[model samples]
Target: MSEHSIEDVTRVVDGVLRSRRSLRAYRPDAVPRAVLEDILDVASSAPSNSNTQPWRVHALAGAPKQALGAALLAAFRENTLPPSPHFPHPLPEEYAQRQRDFGAVYYRTLGIDVADMPARLRQTEKNFGFFGAPVGLIFTIDRRLAPHSWLDLGLLVQNVMIAASARGLGTCPQVSFARFHPVIAQHLAFTEHELTVCGMSLGYPEHDEPVNRMAMPRRGVREFACFDQFE
Candidate 1:
């Protein structure tokens, strides 16, 4: 057996990042339970502060998954959802601009013009249905945990996504689902102590869907990264 070179590892990492996207549509096929467990096992290996692994995940599939998605959509339709104040109110101009750009690109990929508000709204609502993915995962953390733990949980989620990618599986980490946390908690029977952090839709991507062809654009490292010790 030959040892992998640094260049080989770098190429693999680049491919993973470039290929991974927020899969909007998935095939109806089911992901095996054992494969799901292996993905979670890889996620668990993510590093955390003081070795405090604060991530909790609820993976659902088949009937139960469909039930949860339907329940959340119902809550959304009934206007009975609670507020999610996780991020700061009134985002900075730069951050807001980037978000707006992402929305524009996303809608365009679906062939939805900016003037078509109803179409955009309908597309956004598809998120509640997990884009018809066969598996849905809800990530949570204790309310008592600090903000850093949420960051740690993010790392874990990234690990899960990357690991899934290596296996030819696709995933979409969804913050939209967090908006219906109350409904999700009730459906999942989560205790008051646990707060929903994020949700992920996982399965095989629908290769034929035009919407799935949208690859989000990213800024170069120099645009976001900075050097230390400014003069």
Candidate 2:
């Protein structure tokens, strides 16, 4: 057993968390299988309630990934904004406002006019292809699990993103995939009990891409946090 300094661990962990963001564009280079395996292994350490680790990840690459994307994109083109399978609940006003702000900034970075509905549809379509990343990941959970399990899944997702960032990889966790759950379910051959939690794109980032440079503002601690009984 080896002991480590608290200051060093805090600095390292904070660095990884702060540096992680949802990337929009990725380089064509393939992420080695070994590297993907190592990231998942580290992410498996994410804590769960009563040690009930409830997360399933389907990693896709090559032709299979392309096939899945094509299926979903076809469904998207035919359908008019399919309802979200997992997040059916309405968002709070503040939360909804933040989402709108993100959309505004993201589209602006791509030089898309706010009223260009067709261009917006094209941008949304890109999500199904994992934004051109070399690897695509679909996360699922058992239908029998309670809402708390969703929290556990979220922790695991965060772990995966942070771990990937630490290894010079970029990732985008997308809920847009939830819109075409039926298409995904058919492509992946998921059982009746397995529900799509979300999809993630993983690969090295194309830093020069304008969309990749888009950064959204985050509320400071004073805005979102409260301290009680501080000494």
Name the best candidate (by lDDT). 2
Q: Which candidate should be chosen as best, given TM-score against the real structure?
A: 1
Q: Candidate 1's error at 23, in angstroms? A: 0.5
Give the alpha carbon lDDT tens digit for every residue of 1-231 in model 1.
159888999899899978898898998889999999999998899999998998899999988988888888787778766656755678888888888898888888788997898888788778788888888999999989888889999999999999999998999998988888888888899977888888999999997787777777788987887866555
- The C-alpha TM-scores of every prediction are 0.93, 0.93
For candidate 2, the 10 contiguous residues with the lowest summed lDDT are: 80-89
Clashes of each: 0, 0
For model 2, how does the per-residue alpha-carbon lDDT over 1-231 read when each residue is reduced to its tens digit?
A: 147688888888899898788998999999999999999999999999998999999999999999999988888888875588554367878788888898899888999987999999999999999999999999998979999999999999999999999999999999988777778888899988888889999999988898877767889998777777565
Q: What lDDT is obtained when candidate 1 is compared to the true structure? A: 0.87
**TM-score, prediction 2:** 0.93
